[model samples]
Target chain A: MRYPVAPPTLADVAERAGVSRQTVSNAINNPDLLRADTLARVQEAIEELGYSPNRAARNLRTRSSHLIGLKFQPAQEGTANAAMDRFVHSLVETAGGAGYHILLFAVGEDEDHLRGYDDLLRATAVDAFIVTDTYLGNPQAAWLRQRRAPFVSFGRPWDDDAADHPWVDVDGAAGVDLATTHLLDRGHQRIAWIGWHKDSRIGEDRRSGWTRAMHGRNLSTTGLASRTEDTVSSGHDAAAVLLDEAQPSAFVCASDTLAMGVLHTLRDRGLTPGHDVSVIGFDDSQVAQVINPGLTSVRQPLEEVAVEIVRALEGLLSTPAVVSPGVLLTPTLAVRETG
Target chain B: MRYPVAPPTLADVAERAGVSRQTVSNAINNPDLLRADTLARVQEAIEELGYSPNRAARNLRTRSSHLIGLKFQPAQEGTANAAMDRFVHSLVETAGGAGYHILLFAVGEDEDHLRGYDDLLRATAVDAFIVTDTYLGNPQAAWLRQRRAPFVSFGRPWDDDAADHPWVDVDGAAGVDLATTHLLDRGHQRIAWIGWHKDSRIGEDRRSGWTRAMHGRNLSTTGLASRTEDTVSSGHDAAAVLLDEAQPSAFVCASDTLAMGVLHTLRDRGLTPGHDVSVIGFDDSQVAQVINPGLTSVRQPLEEVAVEIVRALEGLLSTPAVVSPGVLLTPTLAVRETG
Candidate 1:
């Protein structure tokens, strides 16, 4: 990929602008240090010759990469979750304005959970990390904390009350509650909840919203909830059992994937959704938006979450390195045709 | 993000192992240089102390960040294309084995197209770029070529006949042909096509496959094709028009988003998709797999594409930097309930 012609350098810009190399550097880095006229001349030379200062040299001088490492794992197969993509897009866009780029590395399931972080830390490849897998039992946040690594979590430290690391997370319980309240307002008395297994704190948090909403209305919650793995087939079978035995008037799912399974069951039974039985899903994923008749869902304020994460990162990287308090943003309901 | 405690360093590891710092460095960089027992001792000490070599210092010495920059643009709103996410996942996993990480920078629609590339290039932030937006008339490829920057495109140079660059692209034409022929085998002679505007070379390439398949089977192409934007609503509206006027037995769409629109139309009209009229979409997106009575579509060899791209990058970054020829992998039909 090498080209015979070398890239234009700081010296070339200096010579073209009739300024010293330091003056050219100042024009690029600290334009306020140069007079407007001289800066304009240097800028013109830069534009004409397309000169870019060497980042390697800059890293040696500043000891910072302005890169944030994110360990990316593919969504589990057979699930209808695309929430990570949306969050990542928002992160990249939000971080770009702050002059930060995301460095993505992949770790296989069998690989050590902290291997990616360890390698990046060893190599100093990124200034800090944005740990996303903060599920109840995930060890990344604790590992990063123990290493004294500068970082922020996209999830609250579910199991670690002592963890004071900066974090920004969406309020799952609030979002699910909003979804459940929407169903209640629609006159659905028997509402069933479908959620992940007992191990997932996030899932339990979401499930609480349904139980709270039901209990708040003096309604019975027995036999109206099911806990299972997060998969479409699992949701389908669970919904089938709930519909047959519990005879719930509506269903609230932990994810859009589960909601899709409920919809599939409705279709199989020749029952019309919204008209026959209402359904709401979490994540407001693409499937919810595009599915036939449209699915009402809880939409995470992912863009706002991205903004807050960047704000926390800026505070973390500041001169005094202020450790900001954790933030939990509320999610809104996307009321589509289903609910 | 500053911690009260300091991170474990090489010197700490050396002290813990009772070895000189040089021996520790050798163990980390070139383990063969140390005796077997001595290497094991240094490794143990490093593991116990969680010592990671400074990547910033090593980068200054090596002049390479080992990062591949990828300019990311969010999918067009309301499109059923999650192809980017899948490709990114594959690229991250594939590149990890090669000791490379992906650096993602977001470029907004209003920003200068090459601004992200220019900034990263000036900073020397990555070793090379992996350009994905190679649709005809896009300027990124040409701009990178003029700057003498090293890059491998995920698309072939559709507009430039004289251009030579390492690229790995899935054959959209063949994928569509396979889908069309599958419909033909199912006894559908009047197969209509839903595609993007004429300006998109990739869309046109896909359209050609349907036309070629029809022509090869001695079928008429007249009044059975429609060109519109790559949106669900557009596809829905186009399918309505084509179904009413042309009365085709089946439909072939350029993207899953478009295919979804056709399905929406089918549902609205109470027409069973496969039983009444067959449909096939491209990209075999998540929407295709999970939707009721799954939508059969074309699935790209994205994982293979990533592997081939890494191979090209290895060639490009070698000592003498060999420029490998472009690669075009054939896609397969993911047959499901739709067709």
Candidate 2:
């Protein structure tokens, strides 16, 4: 693919600076080892010739890809999780600024997720991976640990028992605590909680906060909980079931998606949301603002989450000897209309 | 980082098969030059030892990457275009199946997009780029042409000019025509058009279809059009303004997002959407099925569009001589409850 005129290479830069090729490499990769004057001369020559190091050649030389792989399961229709989208944007921007590129691979429904991870690693397409979803017996994490591959999870392990790898996650319990406290402060005595029905550790963490808050306030938690999938329609159905059992003055939801369903159900029943049943949601995603009354939800610190995840991965790549500690960022409540 | 026991390389394979290293390389890269028995023997040997060719090594040797870069400008919160998300998924899937990886870079709001393109090209980080969005005076396209870099766009060039590169796009005019005819067949007499209020070639193409169909039917186009940004709130505002001037029995929208706004407005005004004012939208994304009344929309053939774009890029790379022709795929109308 070379044109009539080839690009200036390390050798060309070295020749222009009247130095050896190793000098140019050090000036670029390990500048501290070189003297100030020598580094400046090499840097000037490199810039004057627009000498960009070929990533492929560098990968071959160092046996490391300046690429990070992020296997994303795109958000679905009902929730349209804009928060995840923003998180990804932040990850890309932060990684790129540090001279790394993100290789995006779509995880298909009926595909072998672990095999994809293995292929990307074996092919040297990525140096490290950022895994966002960690479920019970996640094969991707298992395989990565087996291969001693460099990888970090964006969420905590399914249980603390497997917190053997690097991870960064938003504190779900703290997030719900903020929302629950806000609702309690508004004088809503009978506050219920809505969450995903699946046995997710993240969901349970969020529920624990409500349980703790309610218990500490000498309030009963009986007949005040409903579980459904994190979707608007599911939330609506959960609300119907909850309302049939008891009358709660407020509801704390697991996601903005579920909150939307509750909002729809309330609107359909000709009930004013904040007055009849104040509701709050977690993951103050973009959908929170779009809906009428602007759902009062807990805002995940996505920028910090992404930045710390990248920093964790960087630490993992640089060390490769010790396990990095997990980072837990507290989510804050973004109060608007509903609650 | 080769392990203690290195897997069989070409030299090892050649030694075992009593052939030259050149023969092994040909067997892997271009097996047509090898005899049937020799090719089968090499393939069997490769599988027996699980010898996967290292991609980074091959990239340095051939000066080509099995990587295609796509700089995506994520859809905004107002519209949060799910259609584009589906398109991206399709692109990643098709590209992955063909042994190509997608390097995703989030195109920042203030960053120079052309500079990103130029950097990726100069760094040899990608073999080619897939340009999905093209507008007037698109600097990215111009720079690629000037640099003789390989690229294929997913949309047609702006202003019908700058058709110097390969592209594959769905026929917008035909898409709206299908929707208009579907509505007309259902006996809708007064159908109005709503689309993004920008000088976009794609928007104009869709509007022309509605205009042509109405003119051909001897219907007056007066007071039957309104424009807004591609968002639900914008759609709602547009409807509020248009209702003061004329009351159309049906609204043909440019996107599913706009259809949502119309539905919301109808719901707020205590009017049943499908019964009071029929609505149709374009880009039958996931949101179409999730809403109260499903939206009848024109679905862009995303899978075909992605596949064709990849094929066009492949053609461009292999030939590297002529501009590959733009492939225009026809979009189909998905009939749902709204219309």
Candidate 3:
């Protein structure tokens, strides 16, 4: 009787190489482990029969692709500010240390990019995901939870229902409190807040913190000033409006970028930063150092937040369904000549 | 006699949802194609049966992962300048437009870090790889070639043996030629070159271009000056040495970051840039504008190069391997007050 022949497998190569199947697998995966002679024999056999180890077959036994996905929602195209650039750098360093590679996907213009999220999950392209630049009532987080896909958010979630999801967020409220309290302590009563969109969670949190601090000092929050956009031009325009309508002793900005704009506006109007009016900002970005008077701002621990996000993902992977949902990192006040 | 039962499959879900088996599969993989009612019914059935679609079974039939890897190698940690940041932004935009995602990986300092490359290959985490910051005699390239993995490099390789590999690189040599020729046209007889280590392919290419340009104009190529590190501090130190030893009418630097250092040194000596001496730099980074005399430099087409690299990878996947191995992109010289 004639019998059909089957292709050679790792077992056949292992027997031929005088090694165990696990050793052969390891030799293929991590060649540095085995002796040179053993590796050579296995390689020779693999070449002789044109045998390619099927990666899909192995991945079936192990339900991981050893890959993680990072979703970035930028404020605008062709514009990566210093804060976002540093965050991306930190993500790469922190994720690489955890033995997981990162896949970057951008949500451009389309606010409802949950279809991309579904494609990644259904295709099993990654073991977990990291989402950043979150907005109010983000649908992406809801979709991930519905599918039971593991993910971590870099910003605070707007919806209270999604608060149980894993996230590593900078303390925006505390940062605002630090800036506001500092101005109040310096005997500045009529303080103005600049650079924020009212709908944003971060903007709301920061405004609340400022209002609480002001109310604690027997001041009213109704007349507090704020701006819509955080650009340098916006800061100049906002400064114009503030100076024309209400003369505040100090101005608190949402970002250093905006503070730089305010500083320029102040300079054009013959006003010094620390002498004429005290100015404070957030993020303490590169603009802080380059701008004159050296901005006094809040410093967010970007590296620590990155590390915590990686740890959160690892925790989700190890326990499957058990994970602490949130981590709030503290922000420090960086005092300079501005305040 | 009792009959044995088989596991529930897509057909079972289709029957329960009153849809075709293909429709059920489509609802699982591509939900956009199915009606909301049909997708909801199919998904409910899938959840009730506690069934998970076998990814191995699907990938075996398809032979596609829909993922690509992008390897980013910075010169060192904390050295991601504006050019690098722009490169990453463009890479993401171009890759995402082609319906492919980028899996980003960085090379660490460990000698055994090459294992990360092997793991990426063995696990099939990506369909093709895009390598950046390639140096001479890189082990990563050799291993990828040995494994028949499809890849493209961002810079020229060290060894001519691997000349057949695909690469998309900025023409540093052409940039140097442009700078040198610009200075020569400005009637500068004695010109100095400030660059990085000679061992680097980029540094060597720039140096060769400078030498050839000088020789073309019948100028002396002796006393060619360079520094080991191309940073601001290094540029400052190198400029001091050049000023003391052989003072040239013009100075060509490797990068704007380094040019800032040179400018600082010249300023401290009470020498103006545009009037006393002319300076040209590569990479029109942010510092170029912040400096007193705006730097005349070669502005590399970072976004265009990134777009081309993604297009090359996509072409490699779609067509047969008949295309050329490498592509060189030209840089444009931005004329400013310094030059």
Candidate 4:
């Protein structure tokens, strides 16, 4: 369907009003400078022509647009996560503290399951961008660098090519190490690991930490103990298979969502967590607090991550770093009754 | 902070290059129009000055910027919902389909919440807006009208003054009626209702529908049982209170979150939902599927709502309406084991 075009320009209005372009601009911008009769005539002409002052001209004079842009990749269809909601809230609060606002833009997933960065480059309304869910060879970072757009990623970039971009990411490897080591310290052997999409850098790092911690103690990382997928239902199916082959005393999950599914599977088999089997999860999300017996998970400082993202944006705007870039924030393990 | 702001105007680069302003503009906007030597000189000067084309001026020439603004009321600290995240995803997808982008802006909960609207109005980047979480006497609606910005809301405006503003909202009252009538049809003599904040128009309308349906069958409104609060914890607490006084045969919750909590509370008290007492919930969210027995809930068409919001925005831009503001989409029920 066709949409109505924007109204005529100030030049058109001026030509119709039989006045100079400067006088028309003054009537719209500095109405007090014009006499009452002259102002009325100009206003009538503007109304007739539906003239809207160029926002660029006005902003150049005002210097306060108060708009910030937040760029995000939409979650896979039918995949909902509460942590994303918390992140959005945190970003909004941080932007508001600086008297800036946020506009959200969603980039689509490509054939390779990576986010579309070209979409972000085409949109130029936001003053700065806060990006999340980075992948290896993320084009968004490269494009942001070329455009010199002020931006900060919620997670660290996977490649060294992102040497000039700034980021704030949770220490996924450290969190996994904490969970894996905790189970080992508890005198539990044969621990299994369930993770998210293997392509995600965070997921790969967490898996690496788990493997390292396990191998450090001479444990095996082979067979049915490893499942790579993030969905709760997928976790349940994986747990069923893992439980049938060889039961582990503890299970380390990449996220609380996976933990919930595993917990349900254990319950179905008449097993209780923290007693019959220990379970540890990451991203101490809302589900962790609301679930029964609570969830023993690693709590990433999401609020702190958001705060640091804003700080990084400001830092980039001030200094414009040209060297190695990326920041890794630490995560803490929350020991609840589940583990 | 005294950040180094990059010069974005051609005039600034022209002054630095000691060349005419038109020459500099031509070098950037139309390099072919200038000689190779002059273009090289202008390009060198632009690099030295860190000059980029002013986005505002570019937008003025194109008459359409690729930006769409999405505005929401900032949630209270530590209080966020997964539904809001889904809503954001929907907006992003729908807007992206139309070759436009979204920018997220949040207004705080201060006494004059509308004060933040100035930030959005001053920013001339976005072509349209999508507003959500409307409340009674919304000042943002009024401000958008005064500025004549194109926008659509996720929920209907409470005040008749916003009757002219376009919106796409779930039929809360209809959903409540469906839930209540289903319970009544199932031979449930004692039925209770649980809702979110008392002040919200959506909550009030749902409660009103429940009361009307109950009263039609000579049921007592005050003595039956009701709790007004949004959180899952609140739902759990309300369930305990309701059970302690007089157990209802069925409970109708404001959202799936409350239903999850109610289910947990019932399990704690050695009661089984769908067996001991039936339960129904609103917003057949993702959580509904994971919860045991699956939650029977009112499915608000989130994707449809998103599509319609974009359509309304397009309509607003084409034919600026002065009367009969927005449209409200209906909610449907998804029957699962709980009811």
Best by lDDT: 1
Query: Per-residue error at A299 for model 2, in Å?
Result: 3.1
Instruction: Summarize candidate 1's per-residue lDDT along A94-169 as a digit string, tens digits.
Output: 9999989999999887988788888888666778889998887888887887877788999999999988788999
For residue B266, give model 3's deviation from the true position in Å: 6.1
- Summing lDDT over every window of 10 consecutive residues in candidate 3 chain B, give the lowest-scoring window: B1-10
For candidate 3, the lDDT comes to: 0.73
lDDT of 4 at A116: 37
- Report the lDDT tens digits of candidate 3 across residue range B1-339: 111111245787888888899998899789999889888999998876545586556655555455677665432222214666667767877788897888777656664756666666655656777777578767777766666667777887767653556778899989989999999998997888888896777788887778889999999967757665866678878888888888887888887656766776787687878778888888765435333345788888987898888876766666354334577899999888898
What does candidate 3's lDDT look like per residue over A1-339, in tens digits? 111112346787777777789888988899999889888988887775435576666666666666778775432321113666667667777788887778877655554588667666666667788888578877777777666677888887767553566788988888888899999999999888885887777878877778778888998755557657756667777877787778887888887656766776786787888889888988765445433346798888988988998888777777335466688998988898898
**1 versus 2: better DockQ goes to:** 1
DockQ score of candidate 2?
0.25
TM-score of chain A of 3: 0.81
Q: Write the per-residue lDDT of candidate 4 for residues A19-99, one digit (tens) a residue.
A: 888889899779899889888888898877556665666555553244556655433322224566667777777777765
What is the C-alpha lDDT profile of model 2 across B1-339, one tens digit per residue? 211112245676777777788888899999999999998888776665445677778788877777888886655654536565667778878888877788877656797767778678778888788987787667677767666577889888875564677888899889888888777887887888888766877788899888887787888878989877787788888877776678888889888778777777776777777788888988875556544456788988988998998787666656344456888999998888888
Q: Could you report the Cα RMSD, in angstroms, for every candidate shown? A: 3.7, 6.7, 7.6, 6.5
Count the clashes in each prediction. Answer: 2, 0, 0, 8
Give every candidate's TM-score on chain A: 0.90, 0.85, 0.81, 0.74
Per-residue error for B111 in candidate 3, Å, reads 5.3
Q: For model 1, how big is the CA root-mean-square deviation?
A: 3.7
Q: lDDT of all the models against the reference? A: 0.88, 0.77, 0.73, 0.71
Full candidate order by TM-score, most accurate first: 1, 2, 4, 3
For each candidate in turn, the TM-score is 0.92, 0.83, 0.76, 0.78
